[model samples]
Target chain A: MSTTIKVARPVDWTGIFFAVVLTLVIVVPLLVVGTWAFTNVWRFPSVIPQEFGLKFWYQTLARADVWSSITMSLTLATTVTLISAVICLPAAYAFARMDFPGRDILFFSFLAGHAFPKFGLLVAIAGIFLQLNLIGTFWGVVLIQLVGTLLFMIWIPVAAFQSVDRRMEEAARDVGASPFRVFWSITLPQAGPTIAAALLLSFVGTFYETEGAWLIGAPQVRTLPVLMISFINNQPVIQYGAVLSVLLWVPSFIALLFARRVVNSGSFAKGFGA
Target chain B: MSVLTIKDVTKLFPGGTKAVDSFSLEVADGELVCLLGPSGSGKSTLLRMVGGFETPSAGLIAIDGEDITRMPPEKRPTGMVFQSHALWTHMDVFKNLAFGLKLRRLPATEIKRKVEAVLELVGLGGYGSRRVTQLSGGQQQRVALARSLVLEPKILLLDEPFASLDQHLRERLREEVRDIQQRVGITTLFVTHGQDEALSMADRIVVMRDGGTEQIDRPDVVYRNPQTPFVAGFIGTMNLLEGTVANGIFTRASFSHPLAVADGPATLAIRPEALDVTPAEPGAAKVHRVTDYGTHGLLDLDLPDDTRLKAMVSHPAQYRHGMGVNLTPRAVSAYRNNAQIFRSEA
Candidate 1:
């Protein structure tokens, strides 16, 4: 009898092809945006920009409204994140660790924020906000942004808290630690990484949110994304819109870096039940 | 003096299931009593009640004559070693052991000294700085034990601490835990489902069934003189023959035993070692199978009345399948209505 030996292939062409396709799908648009942010003149039929300078960057930075919009976006996002965390985190813990009547129904109700078309929900809430004289106010924008954060702040942290080992808490209690002490020392530290990741995601999502801010804070509360819409709509120079777009990516880019660290530490997957 | 006392404690869950039913126990200052049972036997629930993790529907738990039935777990002067070890993954071994001590307002130097002493006692002398997540299963369990022992709690409750390990590791850790318990001389209540664990380690074993205790006695007494039929069938291999006792003789079909008891329907329980098996022509029983287990052997015998019995033979090489064998009971216990009525001398 003769024996046959087969060698394994070294390179997988199918994998390589998909990798290149995916990279182009994500990177191509960002590359075009980067190119337009610096281009001063680009004529027709040119593969690359015909002229490049810092004129648009100087113009966007010199405007006082641009700086106020930047400040407004940060303040609104920070406020929304802080208030949502305070309101939602304890509720998440209770939903995760305690058993009560109507627990599942109450927990899944947070999904109502994202279940339907968000604009439809916004339009409905905007009617109520107008009736309450909350339109064109900071708190109105804050309340609307809070709707977007409920799912992340409640669902992800609930999973994080649920994944913590109950036995560890029991061990702490058995060895003379109070209930509050056990939560602070044992439970919180274990769930901290995943909760931090969720917070960052909520902040970045609220920062880039446009529809709510534009509808509720049209006259007074001008956020970065709201201002970016105006720049894209009314400004004659395309570079003005491109520069704001690039500036808008800054916080998200930093948050992505921090989120990657959190994911790499191995808690992000646990937060989503992966 | 008894260090811990539990009186008529019961736990009725919300669904009306009685997990524990008026269980009572008393432990001396340095005694190790094991609550042994299968699943749903309420051993763990009883242990949890002692640890103050569960409130009894009706009972009183006291340590040193002070009622602690309503006190929370943290104030109960007890420490528990869970089956999962439950070591904090974020802390090193030193911090894990020192946490309870720090909470007691002990000085940092005193905490360090106590932690080091316990670490040495559990045989992990210099593993204080290693992260708990990096340790092996046995080492993590030792850290858990050390964590509880450092507090010097009035009672130590272990709920199947070695249940998750492999067989070899389980035996070794069982001996180690018993040695540490004796050396420290702490009142300990250990709960386990393994018969070997309860038999070899406990000063007295509480055999539980269906939310209540069947027997509470020393290991040898529980093994040799099981008061109830459940304990007999649960603790070890026993040949239970259904028969009737009449005029000092227990008779079942063609087989009979000389048992001194009242005339009634009875269950004759005899250990495998107590039955002697010998080759004979036209015997009452036939050797159905023989298994040689290196140190000893087991013989499965079939009686003429279709009754199956097990007997231990020291020399199995002399017996063959289909051979006629005679069974003689060296000792036996007779039970009526699930309770013992008579026992024979060896």
Candidate 2:
């Protein structure tokens, strides 16, 4: 009779304690916010909900304030993802496969944005958005996000495309494939997961963006985070104020699932080697 | 007329690296020519020019008398295989075999028939449906051949195709490639840094160095009567002696007796196998070391002036190191080309 032996992996209890405690720190507030949205009468000193009702949710849904903001944010994120994809594929291919002028300078310039704070661009970008007659419009918000967002999207796929063996492309050309066919059939499919990851991360970046929304989305375009702030600032300081926080997290959950599939595929893992 | 004419092709890189300077050769139709050289010898760059991956900076490359110097790679009637079999990873073996045919817009039925025929020919009879990633390394290489051969291009270019494989596989695949090229009667150009691969497969061999042709001849002609010293040294290991030749006798730098020589101040090159090692009947050198490499043993010996000469011998038990042995050069040919590498440089 054969028996199987289980091997034990050592655990770090102190590290685990901090990890669990920190996770609870983030999660406890989130759950409390969801609970607080329903409780009608509440006091911090009481430490327990006195009532529960769907009134806040009902009111928030009916006002058209939250819905319009959600729609606006989705529209803005979609625009940025689509536009960023256009700039990313060709730029990534050129950087990865072709030898062109300003290659290093161009690549580092894209990375330079991530080095500095995105908020630093708010004042200058707001002024430019205003000058371009882009304030309070979906395109206006898209224009501002495109600068910061595209740098990351390009970085991920550039590495992905480069990670595919260059000899493969040379072989394609040797087999009578034109440069375009080689890219379509050989290089692109190999880098599929990396492109997907880039898109998901780009989508997430646009979805949670508040500064661009708050700065340029004034007067007409009010995104989700902006509207959430407005509703929380409503008179009486109701305990239902925390419900707006739930709205902020919904799209992030969707993005997390999307990013999981892309990141786990082996194709994207090659991007690190490049 | 030559099937391909490379007229004085010179390749100078932008950074002033003379990769293939004024190099030229003619490959007749249906001839398997191996461009043989060591690494950085400009053999690969010369092959690329023929495949249309590279354009010569200053010469005309004509395929079957038609100048293709300016044509793009796709338009050229040539097929190339690499050191690594560059199979399309996304496509199945059948799809990969059919891709070039599909690009030419052949009908789907015709594509299927053609792909099946090629798969059978390459010994992948039941592998048309498998993805390239699923196949073994050797299988992937076979698919790469099927992919290129299906197009039936006028010329086939292989750049060290078996260099990526182990020795056993390399030997088997080289034979397979030779057999296939012969069956198709396609003009093929094989490039390699290995002398054995070139010797075994090529109908004719073009030895290149420093961006120019060193020698172009049948394998035997190049071996027996190497026109230049570099060809003799690079093609196979040869014992070179610095000597001055006068009337078929060479006066070596180390020895007093006048040895075999060319007409003037000459370099002496002798193959190891050409030097016979045996019990002395007349004149011989003493064996310094007997290296037995299973199949044969190489006897390292010193001549009159302490200059060493190596001979491939058999039977490790026949002789011991430090024993006095005789040398009789069974074959000696005096070649007097200006490209003869200096004895010192060798």
Candidate 3:
């Protein structure tokens, strides 16, 4: 008997099309900025740089204001990540494990905080900060950034804590660990990846935040992104801004790489039941 | 030896649902007592209270005459095995076993030795480095047991630790758990809905229903002499028939079990295995259905009273469906107003 073989398609064409579109949308801008960072001169309609060199990269790194901007951005991002994580731990725990009157309402309020448009809220916050004479201060910038990142940080860890089995906590307690120990050993370890993701997101959010720093810390405190925008307004220094933007992209890329493994490990309960 | 005592323990959950009501029991050290009941019967809730996971609304739980009712779980000297085994996924088998030992600040050498010994005890001696997720269900269960066992707790609370395993594994693990409990001689409180688990493993089975203790007795006694209709029906397959007691005879539509000295509205209880099915010239019952298991068969008989009685017969194929047969109960229990008033001779 003769059999006719029909070849099957190897890939989903529609999905491939969407993926290609998304990759181009995300990757083309990075490629353009990267090219510009090394370009000496590239006018409109120029597909590639007319002259290539590392002068912009060195200038972006060596400038005193740029150096301080980098330092200030690092400090702000680190502070935001640390504070967001510390403050959200207990709040997330309450949201995940407790059932009191107004618990849902309080959680929903946090969600609403996250949902509110940052630009509109920033204008109001800037006015308030100006009235309080808090503008142009480091703490003032941090406070505003905290308002933007707090809800996101809490929202993530709440899901992380909720995914964990309460029985595991109870088991830890049964084995003679104190409640705080249970939180540290069992609850916190189980939520490691999710917390890492949240912190990374918080750091990235703060480091690249332009409006918050511009509105709250302008001239006095110029973070990397705000400094990038400042460079953009100058005709000769725009390439340096592209270099700075690419420099700011490094930590976030590294974070993404680490997050993929941490989130997927899901090692919390290898054989342990959900 | 730890003697765990629960006195007047009542757990009233939010919304006024009584998960455990005025429950009390005494368990001597090394005794493995099982709480057997259906779901929502408060077995797990009672065990949680004993483990100090849930505070009793009103009552006292004392272990070895020391009141531990208000103590936190960490200070209560109890180790619990959750139903899902609840082994920490972040830790390997050795770390899981050594967790409690580390908390106690035992020396490194002592913790290592104790962990290895417990792993060996649970038949997992060489699995110390393996992640818990790498182990099979049965192996993970052994790790959970070992984790608790290495703690050397005064009381071990097991909440259906083997409930998730397949039938063969469940059977093997139940025996292994019982063996381990015997060797360790720790006072244990086991909770399970499976009657077979309770019957085969428990020294005394505390049968519960609707937040109340139905009967507490030796497995043989509980199986043979269930005190309440609920216990009889819940613990095993029981043929319950409603009848009235008059003229020293308890009579259903056509079925009768003699009551030597009682009269009232009554319920007749007979184990399916206790009733014998045979062909009779004047048989008043017809076989409605036959379900054949490997070792025995269950015959559903339709009686004149419109009540269908289940009878276990060894040779099921000999009696066809709709076949005329007579059911003679070799042993029986009679309940008056839900309480047993009569038990037949063995």
TM-score for each predicted model, relative to the true structure = 0.92, 0.87, 0.92
What lDDT does candidate 3 reach at residue B95? 88
iRMSD (1 decimal) for each model? 0.6, 1.4, 0.7
lDDT of candidate 1 over A78-172, digit per residue (tens):
99999999998888888889999998788778888888998988899999999999999999999999989998898888878888899999999
Q: Is the docking of candidate 1 incorrect, acceptable, medium or high quality?
A: high
Which residues of candidate 3, in runs, are more than 4 Å off? A1-28, A43-46, A112-117, A131-133, A255-274, B291-295
What digit string (tens of lDDT, one per residue) describes model 3 on residues B175-231? 999999999999999999999999999999999999999999999999999999999
Backbone clash pairs for candidate 3 read A270-B133, A271-B133
Q: How do the residues B1-346 of candidate 2 rate in per-residue lDDT, one tens digit apiece?
A: 2397889898898999999988778889999999998888898998888888888899999998999987888888888887788887888999888878888999999999999998888889989889889998788888888888888888888888888788998899889989988898989899998999999999999988887788999998787778787888888888766667667566663332234434676666778877666766334577778888999888888766788888888775687766877665665544455554322111
Candidate with the greatest DockQ versus the true structure: 1
**Model 1 C-alpha lDDT per residue in residues B1-346, reported as the tens digit of each score:** 3499999999999999999999999988989999999999999999999898899999899999999999999998898999999999999999999999989999999999999999999999999999998998999999999999998889999999998899999999999999999999999999999999999999999999988989999999999999998999899899999898889888987678888888889999989999987789878799989999989999999988879999999999899989998778999988898799988768
Off by over 4 Å in 1: A1-28, A52-55, A127-134, A253-274
The DockQ for candidate 1, computed on C-alphas, is 0.83
| Cα error of candidate 1 at position B232, Å | 1.0
Best candidate per lDDT, number? 1
* Docking quality category of candidate 2 according to DockQ thresholds: medium
Q: After superposition, how far is residue A266 of candidate 3 from its true place, in Å?
A: 12
TM-score of chain B of 3: 0.97
Q: Which scores better on lDDT, 2 or 3?
A: 3
Q: Chain B in candidate 1 has what TM-score?
A: 0.97
Tens-digit lDDT track for model 3 on A93-181?
A: 88888898998678767766557787888999899999999899998999988877876677777778888989889889988899889
